[model samples]
Target: MIAGLFETHLKVADLKRSEHFYGEVLGLELAHRDETRPITFYWLGGRGEAMLGLWEEAPENIQRQHFAFRSTVPEVLRAPAWLRERGLTPRNFLNDGTDQPMVFAWTPAIAIYFTDPDGHSLEFIAMLGGGPRPELGVISLEEWQSKL
Candidate 1:
């Protein structure tokens, strides 16, 4: 059986721009890089457990993918405003182009969705336990947290 997630790799369009997003904006550490060779990689989380890698590669068709970085409940709640503070706007899967406050995925995780520099869907999620599995895939964070 699989133990747990080790790492995830994403093909980014621009190394410098994507590095800034993941490094500065997201605050993941720059674990590895090379000055001689044309390669850029980053590691998130601890050496054991889970991690993420950013690769310097151009997309072929660029089928966008969604990934989430685990965050605290308060952080998930504050994410939209925090992103907005840096002039980065958050969005929802509904695609109405409005900054979604948060989403209660019925798995009972509170998530705040947004896109990276490469248009990859991303989220900060907090697994808040105990909630009815609603058929409505996305519920407002306020409504979910209010129930807590």
Candidate 2:
């Protein structure tokens, strides 16, 4: 039986840099480090909920990937400033110079996007309490709330 996403892996140009970003910056708990390989694992939600792996690789061999972390509405609302404080630029889905979270009307979820040091797209997302509103398309938090 399938439960949910257990783990995901990404190739990083520098393992130690990615480790500090995911572990120290994001506060993910360290799961393991393989001395035999240039790889490290960090627990996402907890020790067993989900895991993320970062493998060291040459810049030429690395490919950027996108992933999102589950979060609450309140947290997503505050994420822009928090990210800015850390020198990270929070962006909307369109990334058209807007640094506010946007709601995907189709999924009715709010999300803020950013990138890690290695330029891997990352997001913090939270599902909203409503039926789908695909017709509304993606809109800013203020617009979404005005409709509510």
1-148 per-residue lDDT for model 2 (tens digits): 9999999999999899889888877778999999999999998888799999999999999888999999999999999998888778899899899888899999999999999989999999999987888999999878887887
Q: How accurate is candidate 1 locally (lDDT)?
A: 0.73
The 10-residue segment of model 1 with minimum total lDDT is: 37-46
Q: How far in Å is the alpha carbon of 104 misplaced in model 2?
A: 0.2
Candidate number with greatest lDDT:
2
Model 2 global lDDT (CA atoms, 0 to 1): 0.92
Quick one: RMSD of model 2? 1.0
Q: Residue by residue across 12-43, what tens digits does model 1's lDDT show?
A: 77778887888888777777777764455566
